[model samples]
Target: MSNSPTPSLVKNGKEDFHHVEGLTSPNSHINVGDDYANNVNAKIRNPLLGISKPDLLAQVTAFCKEHDLEDKTSVFRKGSLLAQHPESFEDIEELDEEDKITIREEKTHKWRLPWALYYTVAICSLGSAIQGWDNTGANGANLSFPKEFGIENNTWLVGFVNAAPGISGLMSTWVADPMNNWVGRRGVIFITGLFVIFPVLGQAFTHNWWSLLICRLLMGFGMGIKTTTIPIMTSEIVPAAIRGGLVMSFQLFVAFGILVGFCSNLVFYRIGPLAWRFQLAAAFAPAVPIVILIWFCPESPRWLLKKHRYKDSFRSFCRLRNSEVIAARDLYYAHCQFVEEEEAFKGTTLAQRAKEIFTIPRIRRANLGGAIVMVAQQFSGINIMSFYSSTIFKEAGSNTLETLLASFGFGLVNFIFAFPAIWTIDTFGRRNLLLFTFPNMAWCLVAAGCCFLIPAENSARLPLIAFFVYLFTALYSPGIGPVPNVYASECFPLSHREIGVAFSIFINNTLSSILGLTFPSILSGMGPTGAFGFYAGLNMVAFVIIFFFLPETKQRTLEELDYIFGVPTRRHAAYQTRTWLPWFIKRYILFQSNARLEPLYHLEGLSGGTTVEVMAIH
Candidate 1:
């Protein structure tokens, strides 16, 4: 019960050094394993910490000159000191009231950001909308496109046409890395915008199954690249405190796009033989805003820094952040971390980095974590709803108009429920949300599937099925919906970010392609009850894997995560199984007030200078 720091202990013939516990009290001791200790000491310290003011000033001056930032020397000097000793900012008498006030406001008014930042996020979010719109557009068109193309009875071909985007996405996602390295995030997005537009419009004019498949395949190429880049762009620019909620805006807009697509389906439902054309063509509307407005936003600073364009990176940071001081602080800190990351993979080719994603322990762990979440998103069965809700409703015995209406209701519920994740994804934490929602989703799927067995004469049968399906969407919108992209985007080091994200998306789209290709058969062969029940079982499988493998990653900086993921998988899984599960049972299930839980990761610099203990309880 003492509040004093514990003496350093020796383990594995090495002295275990102490870090100031930032999560609880400053005086508590964090007893970490050898892996955590080695990873933390090697990668997680601030280089500027403990340097004399004169030496720090000299380094800042050299950085400014080297980066062509001489005009901001004063700001850099202050920012470097602030970054070095964030805990004692008030003690640093050199900072003016304005600077202190700005730092204070960061916590108080996290959402009150600059117009350029908002505009940039808005454009990126609009790009995300294109994805959702594409999905539901295909959903509505599914009812007519197969018949129009004379493939309505060919179940396999129908599935392939619907899955064209995902199949092409699998091929194109790997290209995201080189493209990102070559043209920067904005360029990749802009080019992908063209793919989103023309090919999507081409969907409206295709006369046969092969032509329609070709157009959708082209659209998938753009989707693969855009999906890979936009999340990375948003994750790189946003502040870490609000990163989850903001990056999750990607899913929110995807939900919004789904809603709009459903509305378009209903609006054009009466167009005689051509209703599917307008539904498919309307997906291009969201893409137009992305192409026109992307240039107006600043490029991602992290991307700039990756290319050694430090001056431009600083400017981009300024536009993204509220003040030059905060911008410089972030830029310099990121630069320090980037230097460490670069040293780890210096002179390596893209292939080498890709290899490291599997070979290096730290990078491999991140890769696993990101991949699990991405796979989980697919297995959650949300996309089945997005891609075939109208078909699903029709299968449930509704007329054509009633089917569209029910699909719209699902879209509306999906979009409306996504709003809660904006607040929850950060505060509730990523891993906790997944653990809480997966079981509920599993049961919802089961219940919806069970409703199909009810007598057709029973009036409540259809309504009950819709209710359970809507409930599943409600749970998914906040948990798995937003977490995957946000979690995957931030887990990898900046050096491996593009490739890492690309690999994760590759898994996502590949599985999506498989699901799309096979689901029609799954429905017809197994029927709705068996298909839903099969996916419901997957929900539990996903939940178990997540519980054992995924570590909580909320509120940690991108750099700080190097240590969190560095913890060996066996070690983290053991902690969760042995320590966390017992505590959860005692505290929540048994209502024990005296239950004490152990923390998994101890991280610093979450807010200014404070260290936080990342507990499994979230």
Candidate 2:
């Protein structure tokens, strides 16, 4: 046997071997005759014929020149064009003061990249806490201020209280995206931090609602940008293995902020008239430390990379990863892969990309399910408890202290529960959890809503049902809260993940805004029972949809997620049957540890055509 006869057998090779994309041995049977060209297009279009392996490239080039296309220059990229690599990382370097910094950032970072990214995760959580605080605290203050300000029926103030941050956030998010592009993530935050004080001081220094509302809106907008940006930067800076867990810190902080706000309200409720203003002003307190500390924080390498300042991007990546050269390489390659994908589809509009997401069956299914999950969490009547828990408890017969204590309890529940979701999300898997108890959550809501329907004289059961609502809140902290963000964050092509999160969160907040705006009015028109029952029905529908449609995405890498969702057929087909997920494993997991290795590729039966046949060995 001529040891290597032409067209050696990969599809039906000597051995029926299956391997990942970057690592599979190049097909040895390719003919070196004047039959193909050696160029980028040729290589990409016909990678199956072995354009990558060095042994084949020279032979392929001879054939290419014979066909008049070989002399073209080729940019060598030792990685796939997807958002991640099978066995690679980003390029990073350590600083001169390496010993002190490396000991701190490398052995362990104080906060994970996501939590550390923008002080605003802490700030936004606090802002949201303040929203809850003001909503809750303002009620407590009114007990004293009702006689002080000589006003009654403070319900309209509720909408202003909640809507203020949201309205400002909407504007700030739009501006934040642009500013980060203009200056840097750090600079935009620093400058935005400056504006933060103007509102805090305005609220503390001034005495009117108009002044307060103006400051709240401005603070809300700034926090909105921070809320959105923190997740984006965290996802970029951290490793995928812990991405969800790290992001949970931001949500966790929000809960803490709420507790802080509530306690501040209670402490000040006993004080002079100036206390409410101080509480509002206290919201700005985080900005001061953020300004002090963030100057030491490095800009997001990914953001810097986006600016086309590669060196800065590289250095930023180095700092975030604790200066581990191995980790640095993985980061570099993954970043390169992401940047390539981003560049490949750079100019698609928000609307157009959003359409592609829901229209493509694979991506659409994931996106729709995630959106429903996010909305369902709200519809489970949790927001009723969250937004109006103090009122609910009071209606159920708690005094002011008891209600504030209840408010504190909800914050405590959120903080406590957020942890398990981070711990178990990747383990339980997204689809599996959603399939199991999500409907149960809806059922619990139904029961709680019905309780509200009973006559107030039947107050005995209201507390029980209200407690059930609190139980629902606890159920939510871990599973529902983190999973939707995790899945939505993972669902789209790497090229569009950021925008996807933006669009989804945008929908989330918009729906929240509408609900926040209307829930009080709805509560006024219909009793609490009727209001939450409607939401319960919505959750029931959401549950049915999730059970049938959502696919599990826990272990999959972002790069594979791109392939798993980008192509209409392959997207769905990824889960339709089983093929070796070596590409996914290689790109996402092993690519870092084994840098010398190549990623695997397979047509996976119809990986080329649309049939379900496999290549068998001789």
Candidate 3:
């Protein structure tokens, strides 16, 4: 075959219309059908292509004919057109439509985030704060409530009381995806606020441990839904450039809630026997505004797009974005993404969907990564230390007053360190931060555990334990604290995002429940060293899993990740461990001088649609 092949002769001894030979185009025009062609026409234009559609199509035909890929042209999917004939279009342009839009949008968009976007996300994210407050508030309350309710020495009652929210969170997490799918993300979040408010109020007035447990359980149910939806909702609203930082604001507020809960406990501790009641009730304050403010915010544009409400999605996108161009560009790509998803899952039923989630190699890998992230976050022992910080301090030889102050310090460290993630999540990339921090956390846990083995009579005992505990929070807050929430939310394809996130949350809650329920028993049986040692071991295991499994999700749009993880083809389950990614890591991430770096990540040949975009993050 020549470098540029000629069209084949027809049955009538005349030339065909210059298409690839094997393709059977019955008419002069290609009948790509309504869904595929319409989406490509409206949503797939890119100045970066530097060629007209007719020219590009002709070139693709020639390239296919030369390469004997003529049969591939008859099957048109969203990205398959480009993926099938990449060598033909290599010199056209470096960027895709999404990158061009990002470049054009750089100056056109606002310097400050739009107030509408800010307030909406800020208010919705308060649910995480409510989660933070509800989960951590119990810790302070448990210190005194156990004694007041005559369960201070009863380890089982204490564990049950502490674990209530997690148990309920697990149940609610199971229902969250279907609920969000049914009522929408906003509706689930709205309903969650009610759960947070009333349940916390119930705890405030409860007279017995069982009653308090009931209140905590209800609060957990609310948090379960809220936590699952917040990241999804936030990510859908923001532009890809800042989505990481903004979604991370959800965890930042969570840290703030932890701080508030601890401070509330500290102030209330000075009040006498009824102090714990005030601490539990204080969580209700943040919940009230979240309920009202969410009413003002539009439903997620992605969710609207998923429902095929195109006009509504466009309007919602306009509201979420800083400019008309950004909104328009993002909306088109979102539509293209949705259309591809629809085609991919066309005839599949619910049973098939579930089966595919487990059986499809890429989806399985993505879910496995998601589950690992959530489980790592839980088993890293952040909550173990968080829920029992006061107890841990007491075990380290602090008096009651010192323990309370030390616990407050833990919350402060958590709150303070979380601020840096807003920058690091986007700048350092997701996988790098996790790789760097998980080992630090493991070291801290191990070191802190060793502090407990020191004789109580030693002068350095209390300070060393305090230093390691505080360092643990400092290390954890920046990486494991926020990344898992954003990472899990971004890892799955749009079709499975809600259920994927919810499933991860379910894993989170299940692990959290086990950890929360077992802490008191673990403390009783293993002492502080054995408990911390166990967690340290888990963190090390998590580090290995993340290093080998989780791919970097920074800077890529949710749609772009589908190609990177091989969602459309299911070919590359071990994406991060593969060739291209390691080359990327060594050259770009490690800044290795000898490493070869590609200027653009040419995704044209990877996806199943011509509408797919190339991502150049550097």
Candidate 4:
């Protein structure tokens, strides 16, 4: 047989529309079932292809055809199409009617963030809370798992159980993004939520440590995806003014999750050995409600619109947007502006995207800074203290009664102090609290380390209470608690925010695992002083890194950060406040305390100082 190419139907030497298959998912830019699809579809085309890059597009269309896919159009000028057939840029479509309407919406009145945005954010936050609960709950329960599982003397096994999920989370970063870019956030949440329930249930049912370990790893992957993607979903749904608070809530939810985990584990732990499964199985509790809520949850309209799922995007907006027409109109417009901007940025792959982040000098600084700060959060010894607090109390000469009381107090303080961050975060801004908290965290570790330096038998009760109560929460609430997730998301591009944060969370859990694993070993080698002091040094290094790199992004837009940091002196725009610590020392304490004496940092302030004196400082 001759290996000949099929004849090109040379009678007329022409291609025919006869080869065209029946209708597909409608290649036009319109969202078929959405409120805004037809209009939006008319105005924009596929982001990956040009308005009319014919040569490149034919390739994409052919590939789509061969794959039995629709001949979707590239985002382009109304009534226009791509001119090319590049394998990557084919199947491009023009904006349909709904997309065009969302794009064209230019509202006269500014809209406050809708109340439903709060619910959406709150629910996203709730999912994040589960991740935190999973993360920090283990720390609280570490006291029980070792003896219960026959790993009582095997400290390394204990470490592995605690830290291994974090390792799994690191490798699980890429599942949400780009994938969700096509699938939409709601679908991913539904899928991811369902995925976690099975693993958590498996972990609950398993008797062997190895089986439990595998389940925990799978849970981490599921949780890591949620941690990364939730913030972006929350951010997208929120308006600019409250956005910081809303997105910051996701970070705050981590604390809330830990609080829940702590409380739940404590309750379940006290119920006896049978309760261990209940405590372990408590993992599935959050996912059940989340799955149901996600049923009512909207796909990220921005994502829906981006993927040419305009009807879904519009319906999403309709479901989440307030009943008021003005409010609905305003949200619709922002979506349009965002889509228009997205259309201008053509064909972004992983390398192209990463390169864009790096090419902008300040963005590079911000990205690296945020990444480092997130790493620093894990290294601040919170993990050591969290997983080992009960053990620490036990070792610090506390009997069962004292240890239980201390544990109760620890839970109370963490839950209570978590809110103050919400207030000060917006009022004082991110940089002030974060920078000030670093030195405090450093010294807090030093003080805790010093407790171990003294002979254990000689320790006093008051100082011991101080170590666990005021100092620990102070170190956590502002420094490591909120800053890690807040700063990480604030640094990246809107398009890449979820994926970037996913990796940051991956780093978060990775370090969390390392600390969880190493604490027992470090505890053995260095005792308390050597291990925590090592962490103190790490915090000091972190402060230096943040000082040089992290900028105040408290209330600014992502676009503005680039413009501000592009100039040398302009970088300090939002970080201009003088903190209370530096202010207290320089303006009041050094002079009043005499001879510039070392001012002790007691949380208690002097009441004797007159209102007039306080007024003068302000």
Best by TM-score: 1
- Runs with alpha carbons beyond 4 Å of true place in candidate 3: 1-111, 346-354, 567-602, 605-618
TM-score of 4: 0.70
Could you give me the TM-score of model 1 versus the true structure?
Answer: 0.92
Consecutive 10-residue window with the lowest summed lDDT within model 4: 1-10
Q: Which stretches of candidate 2 lie over 4 Å from their true place?
A: 1-157, 272-275, 322-325, 342-370, 453-463, 487-498, 548-551, 567-618
Tens-digit lDDT track of model 4 for 329-384: 33333332344235434466755555544444334555565677778787677766
| Reference-based lDDT, each prediction | 0.84, 0.52, 0.71, 0.57
lDDT (tens digit, per residue) of candidate 2 on 395-418: 655676777677667767766777
Give Cα distance to truth, residue 292, candidate 2, Å: 2.4
* RMSD of each predicted structure: 5.9, 11.7, 9.8, 15.2
RMSD of 3: 9.8
Greater TM-score among 3 and 4 belongs to 3
Kindly indicate the candidate among 1 and 2 with the higher TM-score.
1
* Candidate 4 whole-model C-alpha lDDT, 0 to 1: 0.57
Model 3 TM-score, all chains together: 0.80
